[model samples]
Target: MSRYEVDKALWDVYRDASAAKQYRRDPVGFLAPRDLSDEEREALAARDVRRLVALGSHPFLTYNFALRLAGGFSMPFVQDYVGQLQGLVVGDITT
Candidate 1:
């Protein structure tokens, strides 16, 4: 019910600093207005990249979101993103 919304949230989290701040401050509040199912809402609130991918969110979006969560794109944080994505099983990102 919320694949597109999930991707949109990820894109916002990646591109908009204000959105990122709001998301970091309160993810459930940030997502409250979106057309998200409970599963999608919880995954976004949790910043669960693996769950996002499994739900068909684009890898680029999830990767960038993970980078932001790790506090930037340094190699160490990128590695942490990679770790967060471990065991990912991407089915189809096309919504």
Candidate 2:
């Protein structure tokens, strides 16, 4: 499956409060049941935002997930996402 597909599946889980709770409680446990590749699993486990962005994960969903993972709306999380997005867009433009 494509990275986008993998990200969408993850996003689906995050979008649900119960599931997101479960995931936050034990990310590895939550992902253990899914048929994700090692890279995907690692990225989620590590909360590697850059890798997720590189994988074409939805930006808004990623931002939301980051906010949730951080336990609330946080400036650092927002800045991190904005930086990543700027990099992505700038790279696209330069290329």
Candidate 3:
């Protein structure tokens, strides 16, 4: 629904998908990581998504924001999303 909501949802999914074996290998390192409640996750997601949407021509900006949000960027995924939006905007501008 909102940027923060999207981010939080994505984050929750990411957390849930993390392998326990990884944690087993380094319990203290993994467990020491921060925990984000559903509500907080949603709020942060919404904020980042909103910022991305607001950037207009710089749709790719969201990827950076998303990374700054969670830690790092995934270029393939971010580029895909940004490229799609940029295409749509270009179409609109041309018409």
In order, candidate lDDTs are: 0.85, 0.69, 0.40
What's the residue-level lDDT of 36 in candidate 3?
45
lDDT of 2 by residue, 16-87 (tens): 888778888888998886777788778777887777666666666666777777777767877876776675
Q: Model 2: runs farther than 4 Å from truth?
A: 84-86, 89-95
Per-residue alpha-carbon lDDT of candidate 3 for residues 1-95, written as tens digits (9 for 90 to 100): 23343333334334543533343344334433435444434333344344334332133334444444444557775675565456343212110
Give the number of the best model, judged by lDDT.
1
lDDT of 1 at 7: 88
lDDT of 1 by residue, 1-95 (tens): 56778889999999998999999999999999999999999989998877888878899888888777667879887777778778776776665
The local distance difference test score of model 1 is 0.85
* Candidate 2 lDDT for residue 91: 24
TM-score of 3: 0.26
**Inter-residue clash pairs, candidate 1:** none
Cand. 2 TM to true fold: 0.72
- Could you give the C-alpha RMSD of every candidate to the true structure, in order shown? 1.4, 4.2, 11.2
Clashes of each: 0, 0, 6
